[model samples]
Target: MAALKILGKSSSINVRKVLWTCAEIGLDFDLTEFGSGTPNSVTTPEFLILNPNAMVPVIQYEGQVLWESNTICRYLAARHQRTDLLPQDPMARAQVEKWMDWQATELNNAWRYAFMALVRHSPAHRDTAAIEHSVREWNRHMSIADLQLQRTGAYLVGDQFTLADIVLGLSLNRWRASPIAHANLPALQTYFDLLCKRSGYTQYGANGIA
Candidate 1:
């Protein structure tokens, strides 16, 4: 099979999600930097042809073009038959996917404002009130994850580290990197330590790009 063709900048958390998944699956890929700082990227006609949304982290494999970071991660895991990352059992898969979706939706929404303000240093995101609100919301949603970690006493879904952990771990890295004050969540701290032991997390996640 042809190696997967990934289109995105390496610094992107979403791109790192796919890279880490490939590492776990032992899949080879050729990545082209095509977003943010890359000249004539995302907005270029060629890139828009690949992803109409003009987002980073687009992948091409076996004549199939895929976007959406979490979806790409799921597809790669399923395609490679890495059942440990993405289970075959419907209920078990749902358990993993629910947390992934929560990370992409609820957690992402909570942190976007503050992240753009503090990390990206966006002029439009400089509203002090909005940043504080986003930080509070981000911490609150993370507290939910901390509670789940307390329950499972291991990975997000259970003892096995699934695709849920890949996404959430990156988010946790971002939370730690952001300039906002953090809540005292010992469970989350422990969870971060546990994920750090994984090679994938160390290479792509904890590599300090967060």
Candidate 2:
């Protein structure tokens, strides 16, 4: 191994998705604490030059500098022939990307509400009304996910795990840990539990710092 570096803290769900992707590809990594003003990505001038946003996850493998959680998973998974997790056929890959877009556009916003309400805000300080609104949004989004899963095989897109699963699976961590109630959605619960069973996801995504 020629020393692969991952710039992000384990407490981040976005970063955790990349971590799980790396683990899925059997790639070893050296993750450093960055972002959230921990002298991570934000402090380093070179990293800032690469990612102006100073996001948590910025991976350096060999000579490639990769940012964004979903893209990182794509690059990492494709490298190790884990196309089952990413798919090889162009159309299949596109379908996988569609689900990834669904995750980014729809699921990401819902997860942020859960994160802010449950992790960032204390229980007493939490606004019940806001929480309900957030929960309703999340519930609607998750219901769509459950219905999607019910229509598909087991994972998000295809018969096997893909970048979509890793991306959305990480989000499910926050959904389960938060006070959101899971009712009559056995399919989604099963998928969530399955993601937890993976050692990488269990170790990284289980407890998000924010």
In model 2, residue pairs whose N, Cα or C atoms come closer than 3 Å (at least 3 residues apart or on different chains), thus clashing, are 34-40, 83-87, 85-162
Which 10 residues in a row give candidate 1 its minimum summed lDDT?
Answer: 35-44
How far out, in Å, is residue 58 in model 1?
Answer: 0.7
TM per candidate = 0.98, 0.87
Assess the local accuracy of residue 112 in candidate 1 as a C-alpha lDDT between 0 and 100: 99
Name the runs in model 1 displaced over 4 angstroms: none
Task: Give one digit per residue, the lDDT tens place, for model 2 in 57-131.
Answer: 888888878788888888887877887888899999998999888888887776565567676775653777777
Predict model 1's lDDT versus the native.
0.94
Candidate 2 residues lying further than 4 Å off, grouped into runs, are: 37-44, 122-130, 207-210
**For candidate 1, lDDT tens digit of each residue in 1-210?**
977999999999999999999999999999988877786479878889989999989999998999999999999999989999999999999999999999999999999999999999999998999999999999999999999999999999999999999999999999998888999999999999999999999999989887
TM-score, cand. 2: 0.87
Measure candidate 1: CA RMSD.
0.8
